[model samples]
Target: MDKHLTPGHVICLINPVTVNLSHNILVINCGSSSLKFAVIDPESTQVLIQGIAERLNSPDALLKVQPLGSQAIPYINHAKAMAAILASLGDIPIAGIGHRVVHGGEFFSASVLLNEDAVAKIDACRALAPLHNPAHVTGIRAAMENFPELPHVAVFDTAFHQTMPPHAYFYALPYDLYKTHQVRRYGFHGTSHRFVAEQAATLLDKPFTELQIITAHLGNGCSACAIKNGQSMDTTMGLTPLEGLAMGTRSGDVDPNLIQFLVEQTGRDIRQVTDLLNRDSGLLGLSGLSNDMRTLLEAADNGHSRAELAIDVFCYRLAKGILGLAAALDRIDALIFTGGIGENSAPIRARTLAHLKVLKPTLDHDLNSAHGRHTAGRITTTDSALTALVVPTNEELVIARETQRLLQP
Candidate 1:
């Protein structure tokens, strides 16, 4: 354990009901209207089960639960879904519960065990993450109600980025506003980026502190981070999650004045504009079709003009973000791709990197397509100036590991 651990605060969760160090740790990751969970044993880091709750707060919300290496089973409501999920755990004793919380603010810099005061603290910051916090609160409450005997830990997405220096995090806003409301660039996807960066360092057999990395997490919600010395020097996401690479349904990096312009021109309410930006923008808005990249790629392959434009724009923004990140890092030791689109979409990866000719990143097309989760290899040509890799992010494992570490007495 690091000497920075607060005595009596970091609870050691070595022994569970049977005094055995090997215990099943439950990890829950909740978004605005979805909850993704996994169960893992600390002894081997083996995933025992995994599940997801989608469309929360909707009458037609659904959940898909799956045991380790098994097919998923869908359920109607989150409550019933959670019940079915718990029952599916069979007789496995739940040692602890770890939750992925969105915004931890300036107060929490590391993972902490959830108690009443901590829960209250989380509740107080609902305004900071209007979409994410309520769902997190709901999931945590459900977990508490269902398993009153277990120790629930809050593993924050913002925690890993806490190592960011003040210059990188602070905004040039009014002093009182920052001091009173905590308005600053609080980067999300810290968990995924941190996990991938560490994995990349290990794969390269290089010390983390010596590596300058730029990690692109390109899923439904996309973000890039500039990691220097294993710490977040800067990230694409700002005060909100809606600030990074153009996402599935988000208008990432839009002009701030556009909001006012749209409001004046369309005479629509702010809520409507917010909904448009958050729910109806990005690839879906651009392509005039599905938000999924695979669907867009298919449409483009079949001569869909809008889809082609959408793909081009997405890659353009991605490459630009990478360039910015590279500038932040001074020089890039490795450029890693992770997330749904990043890991699986070889064409997307190739297109994104092709624009980086100025940086001399040569992509080996064959390796990019062959690489998958658990396989880390260089996709860059031997003579390429920069190292390009495909690394799968493991945020769940980070959550479980943090839970075990914080709970260990």
Candidate 2:
């Protein structure tokens, strides 16, 4: 083992010999309607194969494998999807399985080797993440049944933000609510945030623990995270993914009273109001157009007023979230844009950064316009007070690495 200093100046042991290991880890990410699987070599961080089974439990169910081709399959549920995914992998020897569990509650502060006890703990958190954890549980159970002999590790999306201080994670609610029900914020997109922070550190040639970075993960689901010294200090998403910056469908950070107001005005039930906020809001509701940033951008260029307003609101809210998270840090080292929209939408990035002129963020117009899809580097000028970067996130690689760490001697 070789001793190395983390960005936070903590001494840690690095097992250099693990670099020669030929272990192939399977990474699984299960959503409400889809399951994505990847076979990655942890040592090389190379994805050997990956695929998805989408529209599960529906007539349109389809299983698509890369390097192969798309095909229709009968994936009635997550368990069926898991079975199909395993069958698609054929005879590939998998050393371990890594599952992306959305919420760990307070039970897990880091990744853990899954067992019956761990599964119970995860089941307990299903209420905390009603939209994600149950699906994860189904997938985990299915995977366990399929590969009973393999070591399965659970990598949580909330695990990285477990480092957040109480003041940052707690909401201004009744003390009893928090103590009795754990009604506090637990940031999501932890895997993406942690991955981009490390990539930013490497790109900046700085210690991970020495940098204060604000990462904006904009996609169908979006969140902003304030990472200081390789640990999450604060983040935008609250108790659920629905509390973050304006996402594709989620209405982020709306007033608590709005729900009651809508219910009273429209005579709709609480569940209906909740569905509106979570599914029919954000860019989709605002623009009356597609939820995709690309579509909104094109519409805005074509003189669509609602589309223009939607983009404006999205960028403004995103910038505000970034600036707000900045308060958690002593000094800002870099602003990282990642995920589907953050990495690809140059106009959106420019618009968001435009509001941060007070921070003296200088963007290289060419670099900002160029799509650095899978590359990691700075998009801001060298002399800018704040560095802006577009780093592609690889949460699967993070899960694979975590699995490798736990399985190693």
Candidate 3:
């Protein structure tokens, strides 16, 4: 394998003489109510096109497609959406399809080509991820129905974090409960965190086995992870995504009794409480306005008391989580920021790193404002011990690479 010359950008220059697989691959990532799809070239590790079908099984469903070298096209429902996506492929002959399946449930350790047995194994773990797995199965089944001849593979989100040691993943609960129900911390954002950490390693001109870093994915669902020697030592999210940092609407960490308290006081059912925690909380709950951080920040700047408090709390929790993650890494080399809030919100980023002044994370005030996709540069000052980078996370590329690896014998 010939490595590309660019730093942090290496492409395996397969000579075709040693390869037995096809060049083109399609990656499918299905979420709770959405399906995200991509067509990629495994040789160059480039995504040619991408699309998403959102609000599936609902009336307000819509599909959006950004065709290869073209603008985005929006559609309605999964069936129509898939057809549009297929149409967007044009003459790009797809060799194989790889899917992103959440919660592999200790069954899948790496990307596996999908077969009847593998599909059944994925189906069996539905209870572990009621919101995600069903939609994933549905989307994969749709792909199977549409492209029966192509080889299909399943790449898991939880698979990357499987390297997490027992201490980091295990909960302080009964052994029987964990064994019987598979109740333990299965960190989400594994794909993104793993992808960026690898990117960090590449940028640092270091191998994964020699790097120690912290990756913060601060999108709607946020989490901090400590990666030591390319393995997840600890992550903010535990048991479920709801257990992490304050998100768009999901209340991050809450009192265990709060659920019971709300249920009894409001005379609501379990599902109602679940909706509140997952949809009506977080910045939305605190500000009582919007879940969006940008709008919250704007309002906060205008002297909106609740919005200010929400912003403060969000940054504080994020910093606190990073401190804990740093402790896990023992020594920090790079601190990566990705996702929506992490990449764009300079104020939020500043607030987060300001608390880490002792860690000597100096912001290149100018550079922080211009951060964007795939651009990883130093945001820290000259005197800082640790490096702060806005390394954009590319989970799709990670999935595509894993797909390529699985296809090769």
Candidate 4:
């Protein structure tokens, strides 16, 4: 543990259950309409308390708290949600707070301790992530107001990917657009990508800075990253999150002209067209069923044609993406799978690996079937040149660790 940790406060995980009394890190992930809060031990990484306040600012809003006899209660606003979360934490000694900000744009290259300037910079980039940054600002301010003195840190999702080279980020647009408007690829889910990459390096028994890795985060919002020497070289998501692999309801990588074409054909405005692409497309659009991979997998097994197509496209795109990311590396050290679908879906991993025949990756049937959740985590046979691994990502833990590191005196 760092020398900064002191017996500042007593931790009460539950009435009967106790842990080593130390300062905690409170992590807040404020989404558009929901807020998730967790009180975590920065040293032990034990979550003392966690809850989500959903449907905020509405009469139906409720705070659903977890595991010490989980229950729900009325909490109708973001500010109140923050208060409720902290109040429930009770005697847990909170050393600092960590807030997840979705986009830092070109302003931040790493996790930062929030101050007036930092908050201002994050607010200025609100246009870059209108749906998320505003809520984040609200949460940060509310947390700040509630705690008053605890140090607050902003952990950006795009900060880890800011190391991407110019050629990797720049699109075929006027250079002035980048200079003036900062119009370029700023990958999303970077925290998850970076976290899993670090885990992959550990699993490979190599220093993070010495490895070249491709990490695919396959949750509702998906992105693949190519990390070389502990920094991002290239990533799939560009500008907005709508530019990568097909996601839950997001149509990734559509023709730039398709938005206008959609408007002309449907006689809808650009806003509706944008919403169509962002919210109504992707797996849902392809399957016309659920946007969930598990649902699609089961439906496909039951002979649902559209479900099969969705899964096929999803796997194909992922395979191509893993291969494409290799372009940014001198040599591939490991290919890591993380997030929801990546960690749990054995079928998806197996199906995707089948398309990587060029890599000559021999799938260890038993390991792959077990979902690679063990210590080895390798799904490929020993003879394969390129190995595949499933390293479950912990973005909140990354935020907590970053918060603790920056708070060190």
Best by the TM-score measure: 4
Question: Model 3 — TM-score against the truth?
Answer: 0.88
Worst-scoring 10-residue span by lDDT in model 1: 1-10
Q: Mind giving the per-residue lDDT tens digits that candidate 1 earns over 1-409?
A: 2221111122233234434435678888766666677777766666655666666567656555552322233434455556656876776667899999998877688888999888888877788888888778877888888888889999887777877777877888787888888888889998999989999999989999888999999988999999998888888888888887888999899988888999999998888998899899999999999899999999999999999988999999999988887766768999999987887899999999888888888877777778633346678877789888988877878888888888789
Q: Per-residue lDDT of 74-138 in model 3, one digit per residue for the tens? A: 43555555666787677667788889888788888778889989998898889888888887888
Best by lDDT: 2
lDDT of 3: 0.79
Residue pair clashes in candidate 1: 11-407, 11-408, 12-407, 12-408, 12-409, 13-407, 13-408
lDDT of 2 at 83: 85
Query: Order of candidates by lDDT, top first?
Result: 2, 4, 1, 3
Per-residue lDDT tens digits for candidate 4, residues 53-161, read 7788776777666544333554467888888877777767888999999999999999999998999999998888889999999999999999998999999999988
Candidate 1 deviation (Cα RMSD): 6.9
lDDT (CA) per prediction: 0.80, 0.87, 0.79, 0.85
Total residue pair clashes for candidate 1: 7
Pick out the ten consecutive residues of candidate 4 with the lowest summed lDDT: 1-10
**True-structure lDDT of candidate 2:** 0.87
Q: Give the TM-score of candidate 1.
A: 0.89
lDDT at residue 169 of model 2 (Cα atoms) = 92
TM-score leaderboard ranking: 4, 2, 1, 3
Q: Between prediction 1 and prediction 2, which has the larger TM-score?
A: 2
